[model samples]
Target: MKELLYNLLHGSSTIVTPMDALQNMVIALILGVVVCITYRITYSGVAYSSKFNTALMMLSLITTMVMNILGTSLALSLGMVGALSIVRFRTAIKDPRDTTYIFWAISIGMGAGSSNYYIVIIGTLFIAATSIAFSFSFKKDNKYLVIVRGTNECIEAVRAALFSIYRPCKLRAETVTDDYTEIVYQIKLNNKDQLIDYENIKNIEGVSFVNMVARDGETLG
Candidate 1:
């Protein structure tokens, strides 16, 4: 019984058994499932791509399979790196959060593929917990980005009124024309709903038009 238990625990390196390979594949599959679910639940961006999420699961499995093959030979490791280096990614990822998910999927795959099952499980749980904690603890601020196009007559008054309501205001850009001017301002507000009060600003003595955009910016949309 002692010899049998010892062989079971220490047999991975010497064992070319189908069971061992199947075990590794199963671990990779479980890790991929976890990664896919986490990516789905924690996603908060403007546009969610099911295709990208599916890719994350497939990447986890692919990384695991590659690592398993590379583990058997040093020559394969160098060749694999060369082969992977030749591949170029041309997709433009506009959202930083998407990049984070990609990295997380890769990390989990690498960990499980190398037989570090404990690390993969523990690390993923820690990350998921931290993300949930941060989501509840952090409150998104109310802010607006204002773009104005008008004659030069009431530009100063508009700026003054904006500065009075918003705490930190920045003049992003300005373009002057023969008869009109285009101005953009990054404005943070005490109350987001208060932006409705600014409709009258356009009706002000010489204001042309006032446009308000949420400060969250564009993401993956």
Candidate 2:
């Protein structure tokens, strides 16, 4: 048992044994799962890509493997660095936060690969906790999009309905033809209990159609 623990901690100089390699791989995988769960819960909208999430997990595993392969050889580590430089990534990350998560996952995987289990587990916990903490603000600013179609006279009558809510509303888009007028509004509410005055708007003089869509707080329609 002492010998097994010693191998895991100090890392092997010659070849990776079953116990050392398995322990690192398992740690990398568990941390990868933690990263994915944190991302799913904290990301504000449905715009997130599943493929990107998958990549994050794979990146962790790959990094762990790379560290295991390098072992204790400085020359091998330097060679691996040069080899990594030749690889090019074509994918573009739309969200900066995604990039941060990817970087974090890679770092965690590297630590695990190097058999630094304490750093891998503790660092993953810290970053995941920080991300989840930041997500609370987005939850408070719930966003909704409302599209109202009506005649000019109908729209004029409903102007008061927009201002009646205890929230901020911005006029996002307006389209008018000879027969019908359509207006789209972007609303931000401080609380979930504060509902929009949808019925009041629909009850206005010339309203032909009223539609409301609830979206992930970060997305705008």
Candidate 3:
């Protein structure tokens, strides 16, 4: 058992040559670019971050380099795992889809590092196609958060105006005081034509103002 442990820690079965290392790095770079482009194309987040997108590609390259250096050495591989475990990411991932992209980038890097080009190429192409196709196939409905601030008197009228335009106008939040009232409603529309006629609610007697904002918090009007 001691002899086996010694061999496991000290020995490496696969020796990475300079040419092979170069090939792996090149493959990782190419696959990383593919993943980055795919992410940009299918991104549905509130903001498109060029820096984060660039980091995705860099992650692939770094992962591949790590794998190549570790090469068949059990001890170094274990140490690498320990080192990685200490790292903490503070950035909040708002969109769940971003996690999938991150995993995809890491997978590509690992595959390239191990010279599994067949699986890497085929899997990447399939995933990219699936992402693109799914993005196009199921269109996202236009969703808006309608914020109405006004006197308590026209609250019902404001609701009526919302329900008249949006079929399923959902009341998300409401703040009511002695004379002031603020109501937030979530509405989904198929197109701009279906958008609420703000004048209808604003024209009400007690309504102070009506504001429409997209799901991403961008004010529409």
Candidate 4:
């Protein structure tokens, strides 16, 4: 077993040495952790999925393993490809940012597995730094799913109040009752002054209830 490992790592007719493989994989793991951290910091609660987040780390690890195995062997590469062909994935990612992170994880793994420590270290650092910077720089839109119950005539008054306070809003749902009407609006606000909006809606005549619920980036539809 030792001899086989030695050959795989050292006695190979390849550019990567035993030390190189070890360093590569170790760096891959480190970079994988970095990627995970970056994802955690940058992730918005919108459509949050713990499983998908965990898969980013796995993606880095597996890609590293695959690249290491295929290092200098065309035949092994073909076999790996054939083996991987049988695997299937059906889960849909709701966020495009998630896909970008997944691809970044795989790229980090591939670079590390091939003993490109510079690429792994520099690229991972750059991406992670960028993520951190962006997290601080760009804020997610202050979107809210506002639900209101009032008389039919009161809706227009409420809408006018909302329009003045918030940017254009999309009406997601509405229901009419004998005595009152319920309306849901997806609105984005420039400020986090939700209390003011609620107060405005409540002050409207015929308005019975006003609820403003913060929402993560899920579509209004």
Largest lDDT belongs to which candidate? 3
Question: Model 1, range 1-221, lDDT digits (tens) per residue?
Answer: 98875555444333225665567678877767777777777666557888998998888788877777766554566688899999999999988877887888888778877778899889878887776677667776556678887788778888888777676889999988889887888877676465665665677677777787774554110
Q: Write candidate 3's Cα lDDT for 55-91 as tens digits.
A: 9999999989988998888888889999989999899
* Model 3 deviation from native, Cα RMSD in Å: 2.5
Relative to the true structure, candidate 1 reaches a TM of 0.71
lDDT per residue, candidate 2, 1-221, as tens digits? 98876665555455878899999999999999999899888876557778878888999999999888888866576688899899998988777888899899899888998888887798899988888888875544467787889998778666567767735788889999999999888776665444535656777778987876776433322
Model 4 regions more than 4 Å off? 1-19, 153-180, 184-193, 196-221
Put down candidate 4 lDDT per residue, 22-72, tens digits, no spaces. Answer: 777778778888888888888777566667768888888888877877787
Judging by TM-score against the true structure, name the best candidate.
3
> All candidates' TM-scores?
0.71, 0.72, 0.85, 0.72
Residue 1 displacement (Å), model 4:
35
Instruction: Kindly provide the TM-score of model 3 when superposed on the true structure, using C-alpha atoms.
Output: 0.85
Candidate 2 C-alpha error for residue 147, in Å: 3.2
User: Candidates' lDDT values, in order?
Assistant: 0.74, 0.79, 0.87, 0.79
